[model samples]
Target: MKALLILAAIAIAIPSFSQTLESKQINYLVKFKSTRDLQTAMKKSVMSGTKANADQKVEVITEQMVLVSGKNAASAPLLKNQNIEYVQPDYELGLIETFKADGQDQKAQVMDYLMKNPQLMAKAKGDNPLIPQSPNSGAARDPLINKQWGMLDMGATQMWPVAKNNKTIVVAVIDSGVDYTHPDLVPNMWRNPGETGKDAQGRDKATNKIDDDGNGYVDDVVGYDFAGNDSLPYDKSVAAWQLLLGGGNPGHGTHCAGNIAARGNNGLGISGVAPNAQIMALRFISEKGTGVTSAAIKAIRYAVDNGAKVLNNSWGSMGEDASEPTENKALRDAIQYAESKGVLFIVAAGNGFQGKGYDNDTAARPAYPASYPYSNIISVAAIDTKNQLGKFSNYGVKTVHIGAPGVKIYSTVVGGKYSDQPIPFLAVWEGTSMAAPHVAGAAALYWAQYPDKTMAEVKAAILNSAAPISSLKGKVSSGGKLNLVNLMKY
Candidate 1:
């Protein structure tokens, strides 16, 4: 057994604000009554003495929404324009796991407990090896498969043979980015059809620096990185200290992608719930674990416009802000657009900031995107191996829909590594951030089997197929936990 020591409690300041807004220059997202109304709103701003200058940058996020960045972009005249529906600040967003202090504290507590109980840590490490399993086990051969209690509890392995034969479904991982080079994830990545062949000059279209598909992005072979402003959306790793400071990328997107779709039955690493699905890497969050609403909107639209059938949104805001009631409108519209196009947006139900799960229905403010009341949204909460809700998870009878395995979820990370435990401790790699992907992967698996079903039908199938769990009763609307075998049968 490894020797370990518990540390004394240390004081840490928890930020009250759920989402962050830019501080340098005021950036406003203006949604017009129509696409043509942008010119009129801009003119109204300048004529009304908003001090328009060349320093200002105008980016068209959608046909009706434009991001205006300038010193006085928030002038009343621009917002009150008859042609404009509403104007709100563009918030700097982070991964849902990084915003909560209790979520991080949970990691510290677990580490301390592991230190005090070295035997448990030693057992966990010894039981979960990174080598292939004995063929006589009659299960997945991935060496570390035993540690993925989540997959075992959900019956993901049982549906593997059926899922393997179905057509691939594209799910957009709209978070940090994906390590597409990871051997387990590489086989299931979505490659752009337009960027794969040779260009006009016989140069490789992927590296030719040309927008071959003319989808407005240049050389988006796999997926585009709005955060890094590049074609390759690779999940970048961060320093341990940076994660401890609560402002760094912890290979978040890669982990989520692996949970949704790591290749199966190849005798390599772990398999995702929907091993046949393809991941469309869309990076909107920066390495600092922060991104803006504009980038998020772009990624959503891109996913919908492309062939993506489902979007795994594992990041979202906590509470409501009185000052920015309208801040959610932009995201709401983007999600609504996805719904209109028959796409499912799976989201995390969010974690508590005070060290335990909270009821979102009665809270002063519930989580957004999850609680957006959208028809296409499936809000997921986290459950442990014992079928008990995680202390750091959030739940709501009407808001949160179902529970999935979130504790100690083992999957892919950056640099071809796989772990449920991360250094500097981030939710112990737990939280709804880990839970939502299970549902997303389930959605993909079900959709691949029922390709002709509508998004609403898919949502219904998943909810109706849940396996009732006593602990989840009255907490999630489904009153049960995610059952992949049942979902596949549907």
Candidate 2:
């Protein structure tokens, strides 16, 4: 027995020695003129070290290659032999991975090495696509004002009375991008104090340039255009009639953004739940209202990293098939990371409400991020004015945590662009997608009120304060619809 125990300890000790001898983040970045060159260089790096046991991994990210060593050793010789243009240590982004010495660090190191050895820093910068300039006028407000007054008249008025106006808390809209230059939106836009752009002097003035912020985006002066994968401004567009056959063209995201926090009371079309909160639009979905798991993950990470305390994800699928555990796992990890950073994620339950035509014994339909056990995510369902569940809204006593108004809702629209005119506001879109933003906007209001509340507490306030609705009783977990007035007490 003693001999066996000693052997076990030795086995463990071997891996420990390998781990300790190498630095925590001894990662490398090797650059090639093209992906083909990168592949060749990677093969050479691996082959050069027989018994060296180097591990190479492709970056899920674009524009780079990463190679990690199972055992630490200098990579200079291998890189030089491969005719690689550059090699460097990978720098990490966000506080979470800065010590990993991975991807970004390697890029920086390669750039630095080239500058010192080959004067490569003088190369021309990449051309950034032009972002569409937003108009100066506010969106029309008649519809939003009506919604605001209707909510207020219906006893849903818990918003900060006008006295608490200039709090300027940041609300990150993790959906399609926003029209930042919109006249009304400009006043409430969140400007990064740490961010600088060029001035009229042209003497290296601190301006919001594409490269100036150094946050992996150029001149993200308004917000990022992640779908385009660049800072260039683009509007979300629905595919032609031949494509979707039913859904409207791309403006869902803009409409949702306006619902949450379009400039309110500026004599514009409609008022957002929290008019004072600064909206930081983070576009993840394409104009078609569809997005991949990877883009969703990045958008969530970007929002949390850039000071967005509340994240609004009004899109989600009705859970994965039993065979797709891998996709579920990735989503679970990403959500856990977001919660760890103290960001609240609000997701929409799918719209599949034609009662399954069977008994409830079957497993309740599940929604991806919402159904995931992350403490910050709050899944929402849609309800109509009659306090009845919408025909298309998904519901599960065990899965859906709350309900909100999603029927025929009015909000902002994109491409309402006009000369010296505010964007047009639209009314009467119906979907669970519309309902999710109401909850998200309320979350912003709650977070603004209790800035220090944990994601759990904020979620609790939302669930606990909802107004009971008979129509949704057995279908919804809480048997209630959202009630901002009741939540304010907390």
TM-score of each: 0.84, 0.66
Tens-digit lDDT string for candidate 2 (258-366):
6677666566666566666777777665554454444555667767778887777766654344332133343454577778988788877665523221111144435
State the C-alpha lDDT per candidate: 0.77, 0.55
Q: Which ten residues in a row have the lowest lDDT in candidate 1?
A: 1-10
**Which prediction has the highest lDDT against the true structure?**
1
* Candidate with maximal TM-score: 1
lDDT of 1 by residue, 309-345 (tens): 9999988766645444333677778999999999999
Number of backbone clashes in candidate 2 = 23
